[model samples]
Target: MQTLYLSRLQHYLFCPRQFALIELECAWEENVYTAEGQVMHGKVNSGGHDTRGNIKSVRTLPLGHKSLALEGVADVVEYRTDEHGVQIPYPIEYKRGKPKSHRADEVQLCAQALCLEDMHNCKVTEGALFYGKTRRRHAVTFDEELRALTLEAINDCRYIIESGITPKPIYSTSKCRNCSLKEVCHPKIFNKNAKAWLSNQITANLNEVRQVNNNDD
Candidate 1:
């Protein structure tokens, strides 16, 4: 597999076109929202030491999976020891917004967990998602389902990048309005024909199947 960046998951979650533009097409344009996010990350990336007894907080730790060829820097990792004196590391990702109604944020957090698992050679059972808006941390459990989803997203991203084919835009009025790539993707114009063609194909298939069944009867 080709090397992956943790940031790609964020891009894909926001918009596939955005992901393709940055990762595959090497296109980049910054807006105020992105600028603010970068500034927040910068603050988190700077070194700061904090200790609560045996637990320690490390910021901006480099993480990678050589086998998967994926790498990135984790925002914060809490290190603690178990009863048996074994060290444990948990990753924490900071976001500028509150939780959404989708698995996009979870997918990104799970990716970080996977990275920690690979780098530490240990089971990272849980992590945290800190939302700037809410000023709260949501603990995420890295269960089997979440890990599977993370792996799937990573594979999908790689396939998309290698194919160099941007997925046809999905013209969702709400999504289009919020999407940073709306102008670049032209969702309304580009998706109209594709959506129509798909609907036609589905209708044709249904009719053909119905005819076949009637003839059999």
Candidate 2:
């Protein structure tokens, strides 16, 4: 398996086509929304680790697993030491937007957890997602379900990237409205193909009936 970046999971969840376009095709277009996100992440990514008492706040921590062929950097990690001097790793991800309706954010956070677990050999049971809009932290538990989802997403992303073919655009009013590639994707154009196919089927059936009638005459 090729090495995958943890960020790919976020892109995959946002829109698989977008994920492929960026990662596979090396295509990128920065909008105001993305620009704001980059600015917000810069603050977190630029800071160095700060140790206070038994807790250490590390920023832009590089994490990866060669075995799984995955790698990425975490925005922040709170390494807490217990009374016995055992260290616990907790990942924190910063998001520019408010909480979304889907598990895309959670999947991204969980991928960070997986990377931390692999690199540190520590059990990371949870992580946090800090929303820039709300200025609040949402705790994400890295349970079996979430971990499974994350791994599944990685596999799906690998398949998509390996295939090197973008999936057909799904005609979704809600998704298309917010998609950056809406104009390029032209979901309506693909939708018309469906209607066109139906029309062709109708015409073919009519022609077949006419041939049978002509033979009978």
Candidate 3:
């Protein structure tokens, strides 16, 4: 019954090993991309308030769903009055990059919406992702497909965290291209025969050192 961090849904979608390393093993590193994202989220998490007509923007709202065992802070939850004049939560997540070819971000946002719906006892039809690169918000409808994917991700994350088993890393052009854990995860080596490769490399380096010593003698 380990509770899953709502934010880690995207990380799990990107790579389960990355998720396990961060959540389970407590391993983390900061690259340029991660740093930028951290800064953005930090700013968002500082807490702010903005009001526009029927919309009230609230930053850093703590959300949790007991049934799903999901807990995290939403970057911004806009309380907007709908046509029915009822204020409903609309979550907006901040990211450092542009929209990717995958639905990881969408799934994360949808998960937030699900949390909001459960917490508020209302229906959330959509949320959004504000990409720094685009400098705009992209709306995401919480369709059935996206909801299913989000739920699946939650279950998968729970399984990984409960088992405390880190999955093997696989090199991905998109997922691992700018991953901060690339060096620690060692996808290229571990995906193949890492033990054998390391052994050969160590032996070769030793032989070269021995040859150099012999020449010196």
Candidate 4:
């Protein structure tokens, strides 16, 4: 089993094709969104630790889980004492933008929790997502639904990596317009042309049937 990057789960949720292109085909192009994200994470990834009262923050913490076959560095992990006075791990993921319409961020955070649980041998019940745009933190719980979604995402990524097939580009002005790989993907041309070719083939098949009827007559 190949070790899947914990970050790729977010990519998979955002767009499976994008994940395939980057992971399988080794294709990458930095657009404004990606560049900004990298810069945003740079601050958090600088590697440091801070203590505030009962909470302690650690940065750029390496994380992995053998069972899940996932590995990556967590942006931050806040350790706090629970009611039992036992220290608990809470992962904090930094994002460049605000909350998205998709569960990509949540899934990634949950995977981090899974890794933390495996590493610490303690249940990481919740975590936080800090968005640069909002400058706010959103708490995420490791519920059954999110865990299942994360697991599904892991399987989806593994399947795509093993299959080594790039998905056909989907043209969406809202989505592809800002995509960094739009030029390489060429969704505008490929999707439109593929649809046109399929239409033409159907038309030609119908025309041939009509011509055969006329010849019989």
- Using all chains and alpha carbons, the TM-scores for the candidates as numbered come to 0.84, 0.85, 0.89, 0.88
Off by over 4 Å in 2: 191-217
For every candidate in turn, the CA RMSD to the true structure comes to 10.0, 6.5, 2.5, 6.1
- For 58-177, candidate 4 gives per-residue lDDT tens digits of 999999999879999999999998788889999999999799988999999999999999989999899999999899999999999999999999998988888888877777787788
lDDT of each: 0.82, 0.86, 0.91, 0.91
Better of 1 and 2 by TM-score: 2
Residue-level lDDT of model 1, residues 151-210, one tens digit each, is 888888988989989877767776677666666777777777877878888999999999
lDDT of 2 by residue, 40-94 (tens): 9988898688999999999998888877788889899999997889889989999
Point out the worst 10-residue segment of candidate 4 by lDDT.
186-195
lDDT of 3: 0.91
Model 1's alpha-carbon lDDT is 0.82
Give the best candidate by TM-score.
Answer: 3
The local lDDT score (0 to 100) that residue 112 gets in candidate 3 is 91
